[model samples]
Target: MTALGPAASLRDAYGAALVELGERDPGLVVLDADLSGSTRTQLFGQRFPDRFFNVGVMEPTMMSIAAGLSLGGRTVFASTFAVFAAGQAYNFVRQSVCYNRANVKIVATHGGLLVGGDGGTHQMVEDIGLMRGLPGMTVVVPSDAATTRAATFALAERNGPAYVRLTRESLPTVTDGSFRIGRAAELRSGNDLTVVAVGALVARGLELADDLARLGISVRVLDAASVKPFDEAAILKAARETGAILVLEEHSVLTGVGALVAAVTAEGHPVPVRRIGVPDLFGESGDPWALLDRFGMSMQRIRDEAWDLLRLRGRVE
Candidate 1:
């Protein structure tokens, strides 16, 4: 069986795709807010110097500039850290991108507290919640590098404002390139319980799938990457098939992806769903893996939760 975590990280794939996309579309322009190197847009900027713009430390202005470029018939991808992309540029995105419904894409890096040593200040746990709340905005969190690359290309074809979040560290790519936005991708099939996750947590679900499969417990895993315009059909179907659901995420449980998934599931399926994510509190300075383990966001925790949920449903040993 193939193991998780040995694959290339999504950050590298995202960076390489930024360059490839720039080469493919002459109208493809990249804007970085003084974080070209850290956000990894520098790789693209180096190749397409004329097409890439460094707008200094101003993230809000960067968003506006991107919107303006889009209005002028250019496809603009504004890159920045998640905190500034969502927090600092919130108004620019809401007014210029969403209000105008511009076809600009905002690519956020270092999303979630997994940003590690950089600590709480740089981490953006609320980015998904922030973008998901915007009107005319499509929020996506790719499970890995391969999927993130596909998402970047897919954004060129999508209309309206799009927000795609990426991580700073490398994550295993569990999805094998057949990702459709707003449609949940099932990695495992089970009749006992369903584990719905997005972004980095998808790896956790995959790991849990291996464990549960070994114990003769049927476990289903779904990668619900698109947050806004979510796949309600896939979610409800999973609930009906498994009889219960578990939402796993790297963001806060309050106002995070898990909450939105629960709300939608409750409305459509009304099935019992447990949420696994960061608690309603700020993160501390620590190793990313250690912090996730403590907050019940690790693969081990996901596996444990799946087992517990199946037992609660009386479907496991």
Candidate 2:
């Protein structure tokens, strides 16, 4: 069974959002590092050529130029593959954008292990950890295309440096709730355990929650899209009420949002918290979902972890 009627692309939604945001706001300008085709920023460029700039594979220039445009009172959006945006152009993104307090939005595409068959060279899983560590930087990872659209508009309105990570593969829309930066949504409620998932994993997390329900596990699911100002209160509440928390993400487990969840719970209200994500290994070439299963992000792994955690707490017989 699938999570919804159809799978949609978040990159497409981001490109479409750019067009809409540009129409209403003349101050909106977009920059791309010769990857507009893949990142979908070309759609906005076609609509507003005067407001768009393509830096032709110069990732650092794209970020620095976006910072310059923002300094002129323009709301700038820079797009590229996650590896280039976060890895190649990281120096400029840090010194020119974040440090200078530039209103630049780095809406990176092809993040995490979703870029199937691209291998680790193109796949980027550490963008979240990198962006969230920057001071005054707001990091958002939408679960689906619908939320991507909402997040783009919200980040446009928000000041300071921001990052939005998008996967290459299409994903099912997991929620109909409104999007708010730094807020988390509770999709399924339960007392046995809480499953906090971000990005494409949210859909899978919701799917596993249903199957766990049939086995009387009563799993709760939280869509933790915002990574920086994460909903600590919500996670803390879940930790307190549920007694255990499980975090899922497409990125590596180290320094990812799961650590923040564990930190919040450990400091505010300690609970048995376990995480399911990519190990420290690099991403390999394979089918995205299949690689996810191989990397221990499968539902079977969720069941095993849930059972183990619950058993440790004497909740499961």
Candidate 3:
């Protein structure tokens, strides 16, 4: 197996993407709500101070300003923590951005249960679902740093409200970063079963594919970075060809990509789908990766679950 390269943070890539976009589009503007340093938007703020707006701690005000700027034909990117971006600024996003279909990119960092010791309030487990629920909202959650940059450009190239969920810490570079909105990246090819995942879980899926292959169990791993406007065709094809699938993510199991995949499969092709994610509970304060391991998202548990699913199909003894 080829080893993944050095670890990198998504927020840094996101900030860089904004700077790149600003260079090309002179009208590209960015806004931060007192968390520029945490979200890494400070990089863009430093580069384009005239176009960057620092709106103190008011996430709602930042969002409103973003929408208003977009109305004037400016490409706007609003930065903040996931909790404040999707939770505290919900009304502003829903009314100003999504309702009007403004050209705004809500690129938020510190998403999922990966904000380390910031506790449940900062670890946003429900942000994806909240963003996905909005009308005309394009939600993209890249798996790694490179893909985060790709997602940033994709959202910027388009016109409308969108949300890009990013984690606090760094992730190993696993993918080639071939990302596009409304499409999924097929990382590994297999015929027996499929694993649809996003964020760090996508790396886990790739690892599981290799381990399962040694046991004669071919596992197809898909990086489902695009949560909204999902690739239903891909999920349906996996369901028909593989016969079973496992949906894993760092978001809530209730209304996340798991629910999206299950709904699509049920509608197109009936298949057994197992979803693994944060349960109907809140996140707590701990090391990001340690919290995930303690919550049973380890490689062993993932392998056991895959084997169990294969066993149900009489493929594993």
The alpha-carbon deviation from the true structure for residue 69 of candidate 2, after best TM-score superposition, in angstroms, is 0.5
lDDT of 3 by residue, 1-317 (tens): 56676789888898888889989999998999888998888998899899888999999878888998999788899999999999999999999899988999999998988887989888888888999999999999988999999999888888889999998879988788899888888988888999999997888888899888888889988899998878888898899999899988998899888888888998899888888888888889998888887666777888888888898777889
**Least accurate 10 contiguous residues by lDDT in model 1:** 1-10
User: How many clashes show up per model?
Assistant: 1, 0, 0
TM for candidate 3 is: 0.98
- TM-score, prediction 1: 0.96
RMSD of 2: 1.4
Once fitted onto the true fold, the runs of candidate 2 whose alpha carbons sit more than 4 angstroms away are: 1-5
Better by lDDT, candidate 2 or 1: 2
lDDT of 1 by residue, 166-251 (tens): 88778886888777778888888877888899888888887777877787777788898878778888888988888888888888
In terms of lDDT, the best-performing candidate is 2
lDDT by residue for model 2 over 129-211, one digit each (tens)? 88898888899999999899999999999988999999999998887738898889888888888899999999877887888
Q: Which is superior by lDDT, 2 or 3? A: 2
